[model samples]
Target: MTAWRCVFADGPVDGKVVLVSGGAGAVGRYAIQFAKLGGARVIATVGNAEAAASASGAGADLVLNRHVDDLATAIAGFTGDANGRGVDRFVEVAFGANLELIVKTISPNGVVASYASDAVPEPKLPFWPLVMLDVTIRFVLVYVMPKQAHLEAAEAINSALEAKQLTHLIGRTLPLASIVEAHEAVERGDLGKTILVLP
Candidate 1:
């Protein structure tokens, strides 16, 4: 629901340059797939080599390490938006942390859909820059989204599943008896999703 809401709910993603931050994470992976399936050019930012690989596997046209890459230059070069505006839509994970980069790389009138901001819960925005660019900032919370939005996401997910376009990255599968171990893996920030099966 979060991915669908970020990628499809706002507007047409087809042919747009969509940027997904933390593309190796669960939500980021789905967002990348959904944007690509929607006919958009997708770029993703990862923190490490494993994450880069994961993002690439998920069909991101380009995956850059946010910690290492010169995001502004790389994004501009990729989109050929020399005037400092490149990304058409941004699926943001760290809204506060990436605010500077987003302001520098986002095209005028671009939409930024952000889900999490744990790092900076009370982030201050560069109000004038965003306002000057006429950017739209959307805060998404799956639990509180409108019923219609939920229905739309469910239908879209079902369609993708039927078409076999959606894929799951299961990092580990364990018997329900090892639920504690599974929980620990997640708490350790293990990559991919962990599933616990009932005996």
Candidate 2:
């Protein structure tokens, strides 16, 4: 909810293109659905065919297999432009690793709203590329968000959940005593979300 509203707050999102990276992950999955619900065409990137299926199931208009496809070329074709004149909003997960690609693939004045950048804790950003595009890079960390924004996000999330527009994919569930197993299941990427029940 916050991802959809905050990233595209500056402009209209209806009929726009939203590119979600790591679309099989928890956040990406919801972003895909939210973008679709908002009438935007969604293009999602995934690590494999299985993840591609997951993204597609989440209502992504196009699912790019990053392992096999040329991402830049794919974006160009998907957007119907020669220069890959890219997406209006980017819901980024691997911000550090894909920073350069984000710069190249976002439209002028686009927004790259990222929540994670663990790959490069201290990344050296490319000043020129960002300045040239006049883009906005918004980092979303729920813990530090303003109270109002947090409340809005929570309300939006609840609405979506209540409407059945959002769903959690629990890959595995184990009792609290098996927390170690739950963690291990999470490490095995295919399992969507591992749950440790307290009882």
Candidate 3:
């Protein structure tokens, strides 16, 4: 909710073509549902078939297998265009790793809301191409968002929850005794949320 409402920080999502990278993660899954709740057509990219299934279950209109598929072509096909110009808003996770491909698939004036960029801490921006396309980049960190934005995001999330439009996906749940295991699972890149629960 915070990422969707604050990171994107744009107007209504109605009829927009929104692309979500890392669609199997907690934030990505929530973003997918939030976008759908706002009436946007969502396209999610996942690393594997299992992740793809998770994204599909979260209400993505189309799920692309990022490991094997050409993201540009996939976006083009999803948008009914041979030309790679469909994405209006992009929620990026592997921003550093996929920036070039993201730029290629996004439409003019499109916005990219990114959180993580671990792979490439210092990516060289495509100044000319981004300038030509008028793309907007927004970076979000949950802790740094303003209090008012947090309130609004909370309200938005509550509304979605009340409407039964939002649900958290738990890929694995571990007892408190297995906290180390929980961390290990996360480190191993397990799909969805890995929760450590107390009895």
Worst 10 residues of 2 by lDDT: 1-10
The C-alpha lDDT values of all candidates are 0.93, 0.80, 0.84
Residue lDDT tens for model 3, 175-197: 99999999999899888688888
Q: What is the C-alpha RMSD of each candidate to the true structure, in Å?
A: 0.8, 2.0, 1.5
Report the number of the highest-lDDT candidate: 1
TM-score of each: 0.98, 0.90, 0.94
Question: Which stretches of model 3 miss by more than 4 angstroms?
Answer: 6-8
Best by TM-score: 1
Error of 1 at 58 (Å): 0.5
lDDT of 2 by residue, 73-143 (tens): 88888898567867888888888888877877888888888888778866788889987989888887767
For model 1, state the Cα shift of residue 75 in Å: 0.2
In model 3, pairs of residues that clash are: none
Count of clashes, each model: 0, 0, 0
Evaluate model 1: give its lDDT: 0.93
Query: Per-residue lDDT for 194 in model 2?
Result: 81
